[model samples]
Target: MKDISRNDLLTKIQEVEFACLDLNLYLDTHPKDQKALMDFNMLAEEACRLRKIYEMKYGPLTNFGFSLAKYPFNWINDPWPWEYQ
Candidate 1:
């Protein structure tokens, strides 16, 4: 994987999520659109990938079960995910 900065990583996750949201809304109305469904799945995978990278580098994006916890409890660390500029 490329060495992406923290900000860039966050941006990627956000972008993918946005696209997925749009595709999901479309799918809700047009459930038979296989193309849109595929696109949404692909984007969802991308979002997961970017999120894993971010979490591994900095810390868990949230305190929930979405991410595994490391020693010292990274969630208590500085610079929360919403602190992005």
Candidate 2:
């Protein structure tokens, strides 16, 4: 994929987050909805993959640092949510 603008990536991330949240809310009342559960899982996986890509190119937006392998020192470079464009 071409390098996405920070703002675009942030927007996409927010959209995915909202989708996940909405799905969770529905699942709370419809726990036995197998189709919904499968769809939610797929969305969750996509969101995770997008997040990892964004973090790798920019910096961490969550508590978990982008480069877990580089640990300790790398954590210091993690970006706060507000840092995103």
Candidate 3:
């Protein structure tokens, strides 16, 4: 797959996360729904993969954990998520 821009990747992650949450809520009342369960699992995996890619390319999404930065801790150099373009 072509490398997606940071913004696009973030958007993709957000969309997948939202889908996973919605499916989870549905499954809470209908636990036997195999189709919804499958979709939820797929979305959850996609969200995790997208997050790993984002962290590898940009930095950790958290403020102080699992972030590997350059010598000067350049994670601070990037715009905050709310300020993303």
Q: Which candidate number has the best TM-score?
A: 1
lDDT of each: 0.86, 0.77, 0.81
Off by more than 4 A, model 1: none
TM-score-best of 2 and 3: 3
TM-score of 3: 0.79
lDDT of 3 at 5: 91
lDDT, residue 44, candidate 3: 90
lDDT winner: 1
**Can you list the residue pairs that collide in candidate 1?**
none
The TM-score between candidate 2 and the true structure equals 0.78
Question: Per-residue lDDT tens digits of candidate 3, residues 3-60?
Answer: 7998998888888889988999999999999999988998898888888888777777
Instruction: Give the C-alpha lDDT of model 1.
Output: 0.86
TM-score for all predictions?
A: 0.92, 0.78, 0.79
Candidate numbers sorted by lDDT from highest down: 1, 3, 2
For 1-85, candidate 1 gives per-residue lDDT tens digits of: 5688888888888889999999999999999999999899989998888888888788898777878989987787777788966
Clashes per candidate, residues 3 or more apart or on different chains: 0, 0, 0
Q: After superposition, how far is residue 73 of candidate 2 from its true place, in Å?
A: 3.9
Query: Which candidate model has the greater lDDT, 2 or 3?
Result: 3
